[model samples]
Structures are given as C-alpha cells and as structure tokens.
Target: MDKKLIGAIMAFSLAGSLLFSGCSSKNQNTGEQTAEESMIQDVESEVTLGEYKGLPVTVEKLPDVTDDEVTDAVMAAVENASVTGEITDRAVASGDTVNVDYTGYMDGEEIPESSVEDYNILIGSGVFFNGAESSLIGVMPGETANISVTYPEGYPQEDLVGKNAVYQVTVNYIVSEEQAELTDEFVSQISDCQTVDEYRQMVREALETSRENEREQNRRNAVWDKVLENAQVVAYNSGEVQEIVDQYTSYDQSAARDFEMSLEDYVQTYQGVTMDEYTAAIEDIAKQEIKERLVIDAIAQAENINGDNATDEEIQKCSQQQGYDAVDAYKQDRGSDGMAEDVKGLRVVDFVVDSAQITEE
Candidate 1:
C-alpha cells in the first residue's frame, strides 16, 4: 500500500496491538503453533534486550492550566454549536456559502462525474475547480450562469488535466451561518451548566485533567525511548516481515473491494500514490513494524507478562479502551490472539515505565 495506508496500519499495530496476531503459545484446537507464531517466537529469541530497568530519563513538569486557555476552550465549544440557516434575500458574494446545481462539459461532451445538484459549496473555498465557485459571486438566487475553467496540471483524472471546461451553474440560495453567543441560556442548552461561570469552571477542570494525562503519557514515552535505544535486534527475520506485508496486502485488497474500485484506482484516489510506489514501500514498513513487535514480545517474556498470562479483566479493559463494546466483540473482530498481544504489550510498557529512574525537568 501507499505511505498513507502503510502509516495508518503501522500506527494502529504499534500503538497497542490492534493489528497482527502471533504468540509463542499454541492454539487449543490445533495443538501446533502457526507459521506467524513460530516466526515471532524465533525473532524474540534472537533479540538482545537492553538494560530496561531503572533506565534514566528526564520529563518536563506539568504546567498549570491558565484562565486564557479555559476561555479559548469554551469559545471553541460555542463555535462548534454554531447554526447555519438559508438566506435568499441577497446576491452571492465572496466567502458566502451557496447551494448550487452544476454540470461540467468539455468540448460539448458532458463530464458525467462532475454533475451535481443542491451541492453546498463555499465561495473561494477551492472545493470547485479554479474560479468555478468564485464565478457565482454577484449572481442572485435562481439565476444561471456559465463559467469557463481550465483543469489544473496534475489533476487526478489524466483526461481532464489542462483541459478547458465550462460549468453551467444555477445558484439555489446562500447559507447564512453564525457562531452562538456565550450566554447563560446558551450554556445551559449546550451543556449541563446553568450559567457561563459554571461552564468556565468545568472547562478549566477538564483542561487540567487532560494536561495531567498528557504529562503522564510523556513520561512513559521518555522511559520507553531510552529502553529501545539500549536494545538491539541481533538477527532480522525475513519470514516475519513478509507475513506482515502479506497481511497489509490482504487489507488493501479488501479496502479496494469495499470502495468498489480497482486496487490501482483506490490507491491513487485515497493514498495519493501509484501502485508501484505503494508496493515498493510495503516491505520496509513491514520490517520496521515486525522489529518493534519482536522487541515488545521479548520484553514481555522477560517480565513474565506474556500474552498467554494476560487476565480476563485486563483484556476487557483493553477492549473497552480501544472502543470495543466488550471482550467478545473485540475478539470477534480481532481474534483472541490479537487481544492477548495488546494486553501483553501494554503491561510490558507500563512495567518499564514504573521501573524507570525519571527526573523532572
């Protein structure tokens, strides 16, 4: 897959253990470990762990949330609760949001994909081709106009690149939008607060709690970074890396099928990369990910917190944290092996963080 897809899969896989399933343990039904599990076990045995315990790391002290931050957050909440209403009294202008019906034509031939009705567009927003939306400025509702546009170079559709096209556009109406005013009544409507003062306090407290969580995460990251720096992979497993690449390829094919598009077109449209470029990078991405997993597995094994030993409560909590309704649901989507790996990886990281010698900056 392309960089975007590769980054997404790698992030989700490495973030906790939502992707990839392999452990040294055997399946209850088969009584034999799968190829992936065997490969992971081999890689883990080959890894040379660094001095993870009491690793020295520095962390920044948490800062107090200021009143200005609280006010800004409250304003953001109010902005999110803004309203949009239709207006037909005035002519469309720059920066006005207009609903339009349009059809694009190139050399008297209609561009089928470019025809849309009741499409909401912001003037000068670049959502439409160059000057297409801007041309609607000064046009009153119910009026129709023809605007000429030249498709820019490097357009997604090769046939449309640098081609001159005419858009027949009809303005339906302008959308008038405004942010809600911060008042006692508005605060009560958007939140449980009875007044602005209560809302502000709530926002401040939320900000403080968010910052503390962020500080704790930073400390953990610092500790892990030091541990990884000290560790080394003595032998690289090509089989393990290829397994991950195959999994990524399968996911890419499934995604293409879901979008009802060819794999080449899907990669181009969603990932902004040619199929060849995407294929070239998959191996490297898989290698990096497999390396990280092997290190995590080795650490977990050394700490006696392997996936086979994860508790049911730990699994449930991990599933809930990852947005699953329950442990069974998580296992249904991402097998029991994947769930165990997630719990085991998290326990290892927490153990390393707890054992670190951290100094506040």
Candidate 2:
C-alpha cells in the first residue's frame, strides 16, 4: 500500500501485457503453430464407416482409440494362424495326468498290437476315443481302470463287439513339457552348442522340421479326406458315415479273418448261432463308426475344414513324403476319378485351418 510501490507494480503489469501482445505466436517445436491454432489438421479423409471387417470393431466398443479402431482390429485378426496337428493311433500317459501310451488295450489283454506311441490327444482333451481317455481321467498313474468301451462300429474286432475287457493299466508316469529358457547355461547343457546363437539356430531348425512333418502328415490325411469328400456324403444321418467306415477300415472282414475262419463259421462256433444272430452284436459298431464319421464330417462342414481338398503344392509335398510321385499317389488313392474326392476333403480342412481364430496360451 505504498503509493510509489503500487504505481511501480501497475506500470510493470502494463508493460508485461504489452510485451506478451507483441511476442511471436508460433509454437517452438514445429515453428508454425500459433497459440490459438488448432492441433488438428484436415482429419476428415481418414474415417471409414459400416464396411469395416473385424472383431470388437468400431471405436465405441474398443479401448485406447479415438478413431480407426475397427480397421486395426480387422488387420489383427488376419495375421495369426498356424496349426499342423497329427492324428495318430496311439498316445502315452500315466499318474495324475493320463500317461497315455500309444500302446493301450482293454485292461488285461496283454501285448499291444498298435506299434505307435502317444499318438492320440483326443480323450485327454475331453473327446473320448473308445472311452479310453475318459475312463483314464480322475485316476492316478498307480491306479488301475477296468476301462471298457464298445468297439467303434465297424471295429476290426468282431469278438470285441459289446465285449467288455479289463485293463490293468500300470500308469508308469505322466510326462510334461519342461518350459524352455533362453540361458547360456541351458544352451550348453542341451547341446555341444558353444554359443547362444547356435542354440537358437537349433531351435529354429527343429521348429521348421516339425512344421514340415506336420505338412506331410496333413497331406496324407488329405488323401483319405478327398475320397470322403466326393463320396456323395448324405445328410447328417449316421448311416452314410457307417458306409464310409466300412469302406475304409474293412473292420468286419478283418475281424473274421483274424480267427482264420469265415464270418459264417465264426458266428456259428462262438454262439452256436447263424451269421444273422452274430451280425446284431456287431451291427451297432459299424453304425457307430458311420455316426462318428458323420459327426466329424459335420464338424468339417461347420468349421469349414477342407483339408481333403488340398492344393497342387500341398499334394506335391505330400507325395514327396511317401517317396512316391504326387501324381502316382493320387492315382493310387483315386483311380479313374482323379483326385476329386481327395480334393474335397482337403479343401474343407483347409478352410478349417484358414478360418480358425487362434490364441496363444
């Protein structure tokens, strides 16, 4: 409240105001933006509406976006898909987990006929195969399961028709994949690898090899698929599927043949009955196979899996795997008809592969 001081403060305030008014208005970083200038440029050109394709599309539903979220989602969905799973005849497991062996039989039947190991992952994943995986679940390795499953219709075992068997499963141990670590010591321990790069190279090569193997197996599967595809697959009725299983596995003949007797003779000897009476025992099995095939086929359609209809390149690769020429394999698998059926199956599975929305665990 000193008069001189107050006058001095007023003069200073006025001078500062004038200085600010005369100062340059441009931003320092770009050397072009005025304080009053808009941060936005002509942004009207970037927006798209309605026609976008992607999950969680549109900025309204998406997080962390002012706009253009739909386009980003579309691109993200398209970029990840790689699965080359095998369908094998066996699997190994035991303990808390099913230490499945490719070798499995009804509980007490002795030596395993299937030479493959750890071939199937179906049951463990909740899909039952002969009820093997399902019965195996909820049991420890040291535990035993009198696993009884009806032979799949068209099952090669005629005697096994609704015939229950016991398995004294001595689940030895459950195997698990030990997660890999990128450490120098680990590299040294696993190989004669001197450097980390060498170990990485080894891993890359192993992955490539696995991919190639899967590709080859997929190709072989394509052959079977092709046949089924063009076979005039009937509507979802299981009878049509049974027809297919009969053709492929020829299980009925196999069963009778195993006993070194005609089916007629075996039927009479086993039950003192005619083949007609025995046929009833195995009829459902054949039916089941047909039904199973139908279910698979249905899944193929629903999932759009078309591996049976493979490409020229895919065929060529598969042929090379069997050490036979691609054309020769096609001829052997699809005489007179070319590879039409084979192609249909391949295409369906390919579509499945193509359409799957995958995620990493």
lDDT (Cα, tens digit) per residue for candidate 1, span 1-361? 2233344553442222222221111112233533333443334335678898988899898778998999999999988887667888899999998999999998999997998898899999986875578989999999998999988877898888888989999999999887789999889988899999999999999999999977876787777666655766565576676777777777777888999989789777877767776664565455445555766888887778766767777777566545565667676765767777777777877788888889987
lDDT of 2 by residue, 83-150 (tens): 23222223343322344444346655553563344433433464444446666655554455555555
**Residue pairs in clash, model 1:** none
Q: Lowest-lDDT window of 10 residues in candidate 2? A: 16-25
Clashes of each: 0, 49
Residue 18 in model 2: shift from native, Å? Answer: 85
TM-score of each: 0.56, 0.26
